[model samples]
Target: MRRPRSAVWLALRRNPVFYVAGLLVAVLIVMAAAPGLFTDADPSRCRLGLSREGPAEGAPFGYNLQGCDLYARTVYGARASVVVGVCATAAVVLLGGMIGMTAGYFGGWVDAVLSRVTDVFFGVPLLLGALVVLVAFPSGAAASPWETTAKVVLALAVLGWTTAARIMRAAVIQVKNTDYVNAALSLGSGHGRILTRHVLPNAVAPVLAWATIAVGTFIAVEATLSFVGIGLQPPVISWGTEISDAQAYVRQSPHMLVFPSAFLSVTVLAFVMLGDAVRTAMDPRERRA
Candidate 1:
């Protein structure tokens, strides 16, 4: 028989998609963490005199209509996008895990009530619901951008978690009655112990996969909000704000729109691809392959 692939290499070896996605994601994390590694120019300082300049020596992405270094702005914009995406994803995982795990493990009326509530949330479209929530707290000044970011994060987290909750519930339900669970119950383990120690650990893997996908999803949602001039206002460097700024100048300066949009697309695609790879890794059929 052929030598078995090691666990670390299995995903990448069987599916090159993981390797490509992982590489792109690593570059983005680096870009988000240390933007200066990419450029030293200031994103905000603009010179209208050099409006829409094409790629040159120092500025590979060239100048925007306002004459700011497009490359620097794009690089700096990564931090804000990544932060919102990550924070929102964390909130989704926390809220969804609790509700989903509890309802799934307990069953009976608890499951019925939680499932019903999830359905109510499910009926509301995510983007629409998040818009309603964010509209309540509009951004006013540069000094309070965090306030807008926070509310946007809150809205996305609250509305986006239902899917995760449903996924976890399904996973928990699948694992709740497994032999290991029965073994724990027979050993007289308390409900909490069985849940935290046995049930949650096993059921939560699928949630991790969902969360990887959610990070990209929430980022896109933030961008959508910013595109509409609601999420991240002026003075906040975000890919969404950049896109909104460049949208009107499409005919005049397509590069302005292209660069940021490209970055945003790649980031989102990276997360989604990573999520797919994770999901595949967890599948028993894939393992046997």
Candidate 2:
């Protein structure tokens, strides 16, 4: 008789989708960490003479209208996009998880108030909320890339936590009803200890899965904001900024738009696929399906 396989192992071995998505996401993580490995050319260095040039030896994707090497820019662009996605995801998960746990565990007026607040945020669309917040506190031209990234991440987390909170609240309510939680409570454990030591471990799985998906969502939103001319400013090398610059010269230099857009699409899809794989692995029902 064969022993039961672990969910993670089963997902990795049996699912082609998991493998493909994992591979792509890993590549992007590497790109974000060490962009110099992909290209030696400086992304910001440009020449008017080589502007809109097609593919050549050193630059595989050619040059943009601004004469910067498209290949280098695209490769380096991964850093900012991935950074914003990761930072925003972490913020949302922490903020949402706390609110969810408190509301779910208490189950009274506290729950009512928290739930209403979450509803208020939930009613505001992510992009729309982000636009308003970003406009109110716009990043200056001289702001560091990280400062600009932080501003965008803050905007996303402000409106994005409601879904995570809802998911975690539901999970906590279910988990808190279990025998183990009650036993811990009867044993004279403090509320904080019971919540952290017992309830959190089991209830956090769904939030983790959702956080994986949120990373991709945040990345796409950041790109949209940039494309609209309000996200990352000049001097920050990101796929979104590159794509925005390419739009004006689409007729003359299609490569400008194609390369960065492709990268952004692939990165977003990879995170989404990875999230699906994790969710499937965690849910036995999904495995059978």
Candidate 3:
């Protein structure tokens, strides 16, 4: 059953988890959008004199091995990481949703072919596939930040979309046979009109929930790839890159590892909690439970 807007809002409001997770996600967005609001210090400006220094007067988070302000770098790091997560999630949802909807609605051999392809892609692990793709088309030292980010996003989307496609395919199969859909067909509605106006709105809730969680998943994956030195390279200054830089200095400067890792963990957790909140609110059974 479709929930009324007011009821949905009420349900979200009633969940304390929703508020906490929403606040974290909101802060992350602000940090990504305007790091200067948090600190005026330059993220890129490095001072070799301050290398590996602990917290000081102006630099609360101190400096890293590269002598860049850890506070500033951590603040600015949100931009690239969030960009990769959001962009990759959008691509995966769009591509997977389209394929799933088409296959589910058209059925027959179309469904069989797409399902087989999805299974094959699903069989490949996300990280392994991404690693292979990244290695196959290495981003040279001269590649721009945007180019590097795009390659990571593309790799993630290609490998990670199977789950979304499968979810959407199942949802569409259940939805297309519903009374509203059948009624629309009997009322002389065109296939496109019925699909766009009726089917998609009803079918998208599950996908929305999955995409929410996938944002965090992709962010973590990006960080892992960067940590392994095949993901986002330097000059991009993602949380992953910072974490990678901190690997060798774990004992000497634990702050470097702790700060970025904490931020990444919290961000990922927030998304996951938000996804749980969404899922609970949308599903009457979960809400009742």
Candidate 4:
């Protein structure tokens, strides 16, 4: 008798980590989407009368020196972090997959050249490299938020893909030499056919797992940049910037730092846990569990 599809899903759902991660992600998605739902105050607007108020009846999370609601800022901040994380991860996966597949399949001078390029990026400090690129191109130069986001996405992607490329290259090399790939080649199949049909599919599993982990890494990088005043500038509220701004008044108004930092921490933890769950689920050893 065949097991029901629901049974399979039920078994997978029994993994506590996956459920926790899913709940966290769901909360973040909601926070990012309808930020106004969490608070009525405008994050950018300041009310002098309410400035620097501690957590109280009206303002539960308190107010910054400018009287901007901390809760609102943090909720909106989620949008920037989520957008950057998703976009950067996508850019890395696409570019890295192409480069890794080509180098691995062609293998020779092509592999050497690509490998060396990957090494160059790996040598650089990822966050610092991104900050330099971001600072070099002033936000004023960009026509719109979309333009600025595109540039940031590209910068992060360029730096982030080196690791992904290396992983994909290794996976491709192993998959290409497998029995099925050799069989395809023996049948006079074209390189393109063997790669797309027999090699890429098998090679991509590890890449998928890596990409999941990379989302959390990119989020942290974006946050670091924002904290240093190089990421998601004014009009774009990001958690890093919020936490950075809160640092000054952390002693007087700890809630300002607490709420935003909590959100960032939870979001990062969710992604990390999700990646771990995916890794375990994909592992052959775990299949028997």
Candidate 5:
């Protein structure tokens, strides 16, 4: 008998956290795709006449010190946050997954060398490593916004992959010893084929959950870099840059800080909840509970 097609959807529907995460992703996609449709004002262009204006009829989120519409900027900023989060997560999954799977499946000197490299990364805190990279390559030196984004993505990716690598390595090690994997090996399959076709498929579930969590971490990292004045430069709107710009006037014009912080918090929370949901759904232990 075939399983019900709606099984996964039914499971997801039973989890409110999953629903909220889906909603957040949808909102972010809309914000990223058509930021201008949400607001008339350009995020980069400043209106001298309306500088530092509080939230009003047209400007619900208010204007920044430079008089750029905060609402528009926040909406547009979603683009950077989501883009960086996704790209960084993909980088982590690809690079970390390959390194981990190779080490764990082979289980020899290969494992020792890769495991040591992973340990070295763990010894160095992720944020501190990212900060060092950002400082080394300032945003001002970038040729364009794309280049700046590339730098931020690379910095976060380098620091972020360690955890994923460790998690994936553990998963791969367990999967490599499973019945199907041994069967494949007994059948005289190539090591690469057994690892890729048999072991990786089963081992990837935990990595998927971890990758979801990594999205939130990357967003926070990008924001931290921007807050410290190293992330996405001017002419580009980012939640971190917006929040940083609002820090001085947080007391006087609370809207400046409030909106961006709220959005960033929501984005991070959404990803966290989503990661939990994925973990619960993917793990048989959690699902049985």
Candidate 6:
């Protein structure tokens, strides 16, 4: 069932899921990059009288219980959410890839020890572990926005890298004995050069795909943490905080819950879909199946 490279590319183009997922992701990145292009209204501008106001002339998303324009808040919140997801994913990939690639390429005690460590870390739940770690950075006294962002990234990365490590390890093992790798090894190439020139380039595709999917998961986790009052706080308008603030008033103004929830879902779903598309495109097994 293996098709020509051109055929595979053509198939991907014909796949509706690819375009839909890619388009949605593109829109989100745009929103996150420059909310001004989409909406000029200040998200923080609020009025007591405007509280709970229904959709008006320009406010398609209506006003929140705080009388803030829901549309603007949602627009601005994308930046925080996207920023955290991207940053966290990059950290996870770097840490995970390094651990995995080394363990995979150099088997023996190193592999055994790293693998055991990975298992121990993997057994701990991401959310629970992150919450435990984040608890130390209490919201009281208000940690700086950058400091809070770093804490969340570190918490997630600590646990997140295990899977990435496993993937990288597996990939490296699969590629380490390939002809090119052997040739490089025979040429007196140093460990670093052999690894950089041969192993990683070949083994990194799958991990990249998985990391792409994990971005959505990371974003969702950030929202969950914020909802629980730990991740990002006031002065930093994230979708999670907005959702958390709106939950109490859900019954009165369902849009409060609906708007942020919708945005979060769409963002997460888009990334998941993009990941799926990338995996399918790159992984021949999926296409064969």
Per lDDT, the best of the predicted structures is 3
Model 6 stretches with alpha carbons more than 4 Å out: 1-11, 139-142
lDDT of 2 by residue, 35-85 (tens): 999999999899999999999999999998789999999999899999999
The number of residue pairs in model 3 that clash at the backbone is 0
TM-score of each: 0.93, 0.96, 0.96, 0.91, 0.95, 0.94
Residue-level lDDT tens digits of model 3 in 245-281: 9999999999989999999999999999998888778
Cα lDDT, all candidates: 0.87, 0.91, 0.92, 0.83, 0.85, 0.89
Model 1, poorest ten-residue lDDT window?
A: 1-10
Clash pairs detected, candidate 2: none
TM-score between candidate 2 and the true structure: 0.96
Clashes of each: 0, 0, 0, 0, 0, 0
Candidate 4's displacement at residue 4, Å, is 16
Clashing pairs in 3: none
- In Å, residue 282's CA in model 5 sits off its true spot by 1.4
The better candidate by TM-score, 1 or 2, is 2
Sort every candidate by TM-score, greatest first. Answer: 3, 2, 5, 6, 1, 4
Off by over 4 Å in 2: 1-5
- How much does each candidate deviate from the true structure in C-alpha RMSD? 2.4, 1.8, 1.4, 2.7, 1.8, 2.1
Off by over 4 Å in 3: 1-4
Native-to-model Cα distance after best TM-score fit, residue 164 in candidate 2, in Å: 0.6
Ranking by lDDT: 3, 2, 6, 1, 5, 4
Q: What RMSD does model 2 have?
A: 1.8
